[model samples]
Target: MRTFYLLSLLLFALASCQQPAQYISNEGYIYGTIYHVTYESPQGKDLQPEIEAVMMELNQSMSTFDSTSTISKVNKNEPTELDELFITIFKQAQKISELTDGAFDITVAPMVNVWGFGFKNKEQVTPQLIDSLKQLVGYQKVHLENGQLMKDHPNTMLDASAIAKGFACDMVADYLYSQGCKNLMAEIGGEVVAKGKNAKGNYWSIGISKPDDNEFFTQQKLKAIVELQDRALATSGNYRNFYVEDGIKYAHTIDPKTGYPVQHSLLSTTVLADNCMTADAYATAFMVSGLEKSIAIAEADPEIDVYFIYSDPNGNYQTYVSPGFKKLLKKEYE
Candidate 1:
């Protein structure tokens, strides 16, 4: 009887170890893709609904693409007490702006519009127009006053596209954790953040797509496959959202200081950090900085690792990776 009782207890323990349920939340079909969140579940149906609510709030809060967004309001007003979500994103934007030395300014919206990359009606902007736009593209002119956002100059719009999606991903991850989710992965566009493991009890495997000539699919070649346990990853590439005029290819990522597209040899940059916002912002900063300077930046900051792909003057593709990034590469592909 004692042996049978012990066996029963062992079986119970095994049964209790069964995998948790899984749920997926997806929202916002903008910029040509869908943002999604996946979490361990058996959670109430309200789980997805709540996650969607957070995403909706973020879209309403941070989208400069929308005329009704909080950023739009702040740009049009002298002082506005932004919602906590907008405030959080604004703080991160300021930090990144300082770090990149204005290479990644949120106030580059005017340039973005002038270059026809934004919601503004597309038009061919001349060098004179670009020069005028640069005058308004400085983070120093924008200030956060007692949690109230204020822009010193009028007609100076703020575009949080560089960091807002990643912020949304982080917010979704935090919300999932609050709902007792032990594991979750949230991806807003290409910006991704993962917590805990998948249903298989293994880390989530994320693939970095190689920038190839074909825009339809990421090159079959894998740049890096990371096993994310509790981290975020973001990639910025010129392959998407680019237009070639008179043999010069112009990408959407504009240099805030130059008021023009970055004409560097760097093709793409991928960053891995503790949060999606940092990863997203750093990726764009590194992309703008090009290869050598970006490597120096990554080496100086141990908290972030970067991978850069560049084209030589001869148009040959070459890749350079930071020391910290080497640690994250799965051995089989490394």
Candidate 2:
């Protein structure tokens, strides 16, 4: 009887030492892009409905395409009380606009729409049209008073497309954390917020897509791969959304100050920050600031890490990595 009892205890200990549960991956469409989330937890639960609830709520608050969205009402100059998400994004956008000296502006929707990149149809773009739209494109002209957004000009609309996706990624990650998840990766579009460890029991791996307009979704080549744990990553590039007319290439990334798509060699910029929202806004700002100015700004801010890929004078690709960004790279493309 003693030998049998000892054998039973040994077998129970072996069963208790079994491997942990595998990671669960959930993916779907949101905000006009694909979103992917993966998490590992000891307790199994299907959190898709909860995650989609968060996404739909955010969309109702910020989606310009949705006529019933809070942002749409504000855009139409309707007297709408801004939601917490809209207010938070607006406040952050104002700060980024000030920091980048108008390189990042939510009030550039008129220019964006005129360029055929927004909700409105494309118009006959000319110097006069650009100059006229420039009158409506200043962040200082908009303010929030008692939860209401006030605009100096009736047409000075707000568009949060630049930062909304990143904010969504952060929101989803926050929800996962609140649910007792210690390891997870949340990505919306290309913006990502990675926390804890991945399925491999290591830092989450993120890939930076190469700045190629022709093979954006088809080839999908990665320029670099980095381990991002407890970090948010965002990338901005002008190659994908663009049109060519009269031998001139017009990209969707417009300069808020100039009221025209930027004509710079800076192809793409990737930024890493504690939050995806900031990273997303800065990525767009850096694209406007160009490579040299962007490097200067990133160098001054110790918390910001950046990786830049630009076209050199010889038309060949060249890369610039911030001192901190270089440390994150696990693989670098030649």
Candidate 3:
């Protein structure tokens, strides 16, 4: 899930009123998180079954929790022809890894697990242990050779959790578009794709959350509100999934290159891109690269607009809004 929040039917129009008739909405849980879909259809089509089916297919191909899932089978080193979803995700992951100089790696799952960010309990990780684990980690260590997934080490695994929700959002949103639905928004776990207008015929409103250590998201507060249309928004942060040990802080986002959690003041990154998958990957890349490199990456990519929240030297919250994202901000904070 994202530290960002999808603003609930609150368009910034002068007149704020309810219009359930124009927008058909569905809310439920899938892929271990919440999903919300809204679209404008005069015929009032109930596509919950279709949307749920999409989620089911994605889970079968990518969910690590499913023992029989395609990814799980691959992790087990079984001879399997990767499904279309699996191939697509794997290819996309490789592209992002190269783009970010391996900042966003799917092969870092084993390291993450050892850090207690995955299914395993946290242990006292030493430099020796890290060096040993680094052997089983690296995007270059895995590849699609002649249409088969090949790994450098038998234990080298892949975990697409970082980009799954964003891809799910894109799949759901693209499915709706193919069905001729207009003026719609699809959001899975805060990675979102909003198109056209909403029920009140205004841009979709999304809220970026304050980067506080509210791990369970018990309380929600808006750091900024964005007006979005025809674009995807994804946010990545480590503030929520972190701990302090003996005055040393450890975050869940393990650096793939170093086999350790990143130590940086960069709190969160919200990226807008032509698609949710790209936005999701770069958001994590920005977090891993920290402030200066993140700014550099955003500046180089014309298709990307980013909103970065970081702490100043004084530990006060400050914002860095890329030129493209600045225009989308309906509200801002100091």
Candidate 4:
């Protein structure tokens, strides 16, 4: 799925109207793009070092790129003490996995590797191979013991790529706020968490991309736009990672229950919630659940608002929004 990084230029424009003293700079990396956090405070420079320090700690604590990360230890079945940050994120992931009926599994790493999305052999997988790989997929195989983690089964790896980035953004945002940043925007791999007002003194406006066959117009399609203060938004779509074989498209997102890539017609789903982790995980879960069930789940939860784009069996494209989501859409788009 493609996640977008957006800089609030409108906030900058508005800040200029109020004073000549405010400055903003963004920093972070997601999908080869530098995901940034725009900081606007009267004393911005003093906080830069502190922000950098927190970012460093976060990278060390959670980064999959680091072979020594807490998640890596858990996946390797090595004994390790759980940091508070790791515990918080792991709990949230586990809760979502259960709530979604294993639809949002963190232990999908093996499947991702077998499908050639990770550092695997990078070969086309056969049905027999997929079946074997599916045997290793399940949330139940992962366990959290007394202050430690244990992988109950062999080859059951953890891939927190789905929600960890967003969780990281939330943690960073919380840190920024603690550092006296009243107006800030944190984005990691297109998942965003906005706090306080933008430079314009209005909520941050984020553009949700359209699922288009042409990559050039993905951003231009602008399925929906949202303005947020103290909220996080995450979008999941099949357009970003997929392979075609025999005229069939196989997306990177795998269903843990079936151990195969989902074959839903929905192109994208965006979720807005109080935290990026929830939004991030739910976006993936809803995408796998397809249109009807996604809507049903969103309706059942007042905290979640979802926007979905699907292709009808007749080849017509349609968009569906939950009641909670309609308020966030631009009037024209709604």
Choose the strongest candidate by lDDT: 2
Q: Locate the minimum summed-lDDT window of 10 residues in model 2.
A: 115-124
Q: Write the per-residue lDDT of candidate 1 for residues 253-307, one digit (tens) a residue.
A: 7888887777767888888899999999889888778788788777877788777
lDDT for each residue of candidate 2 in 1-334, tens digit (9 for 90 to 100): 9999999999999988765665789999998889999987556676889999998999999999999999999999887888899999999999888888889999988888887744134457889998999889999999988879998999898899998889999999999889878899999989999999987789999999888877956978899998896999999988787777687666668899998777778888999999999999999999888989888888877778999999998878899998788998999876
RMSD of each: 4.9, 4.1, 10.3, 10.0
If both were scored by TM-score, which would come out higher, candidate 1 or candidate 2? Answer: 2
- C-alpha TM-scores of all predictions: 0.86, 0.90, 0.90, 0.86
Give lDDT tens digits, candidate 3, residues 86-157: 998889889989988899999998888887744246667888989999999999999898878998999998
Runs in model 4 deviating more than 4 A are 1-23, 28-33, 46-49, 118-124, 216-220, 331-334
How do all the candidates rank in terms of lDDT, highest first? 2, 3, 1, 4
Query: What local distance difference test score does each model get?
Result: 0.78, 0.88, 0.87, 0.77
Clashes (backbone N, CA, C under 3 Å), per candidate, total 1, 0, 0, 1
User: The CA-based lDDT of model 2 is what?
Assistant: 0.88
How well does candidate 2 score on lDDT at residue 179? 85
TM-score of predicted structure 1: 0.86
Q: What residue runs in model 3 are displaced by over 4 Å at the alpha carbon? A: 1-21, 118-120, 214-218
Model 2 spans with C-alpha error above 4 angstroms: 1-22, 118-123, 214-217, 245-248
| Model 4 vs truth, CA RMSD | 10.0
lDDT of 1 at 245: 65
